[model samples]
Target: MKDRFVANQNAHLEMVLQQMTERLLQATSRLMARQGRPPQCNYEKKQNVWSLATSRRHCVE
Candidate 1:
């Protein structure tokens, strides 16, 4: 029973992380657009799932 509970908890955590990552990406894209720049997003994998690695914008003057 404990093993099953742990598995369920992990799955739930992964789903929540994925949703948060998606929202972050959208907001980052919008912000970059407003600033006339583009976002360079990177994804990293953790425990067989991809998560938001970094959000960066390049500024050219």
Candidate 2:
């Protein structure tokens, strides 16, 4: 029963994480759209996991 409970909790956590990721991406897209520029993405490796970092470049034009 304990293993079942743990499995259920893990599933819930994964679902919540996925939802958060989707929301973040949506917000980022909207922000870029409003700014009228695409974000520059950088990938950094940390603890064997790759994560994305984004920055908006100041347009000189």
Candidate 3:
């Protein structure tokens, strides 16, 4: 049970980090757009970004 908890916590941390990275990337992209520069992500254009990596935009994906 202790090991399982540790594993679960690690997974949650990784997921959180991934979500933050995606948000930063998108925000950086948008900032660059306003500065007359292009984004480096090259993510496929979607009607909305509610799905940066997973299909949810909540703080944790």
Give a tens-digit lDDT track for model 1, residues 1-61.
9998986896687679778876777787788889998666533333224422321111211
- What TM-score goes with each of the models? 0.64, 0.61, 0.65
Better of 1 and 3 by TM-score: 3
lDDT tens digits by residue: candidate 2, 3-52: 98986896687568656766676677678879997755321222113122
Query: What is the lDDT of every predicted structure here?
Result: 0.60, 0.54, 0.67
Assess the local accuracy of residue 35 in candidate 2 as a C-alpha lDDT between 0 and 100. 98
Q: What is the C-alpha RMSD of each candidate to the true structure, in Å?
A: 11.9, 13.3, 6.7
Model number with the top TM-score: 3
Give the residue spans of candidate 1 off by over 4 A. Answer: 42-61
Off by over 4 Å in 3: 44-61
Span of 10 residues, lowest total lDDT, candidate 1: 52-61
Model 2 residue 21 CA deviation (Å) reads 0.6
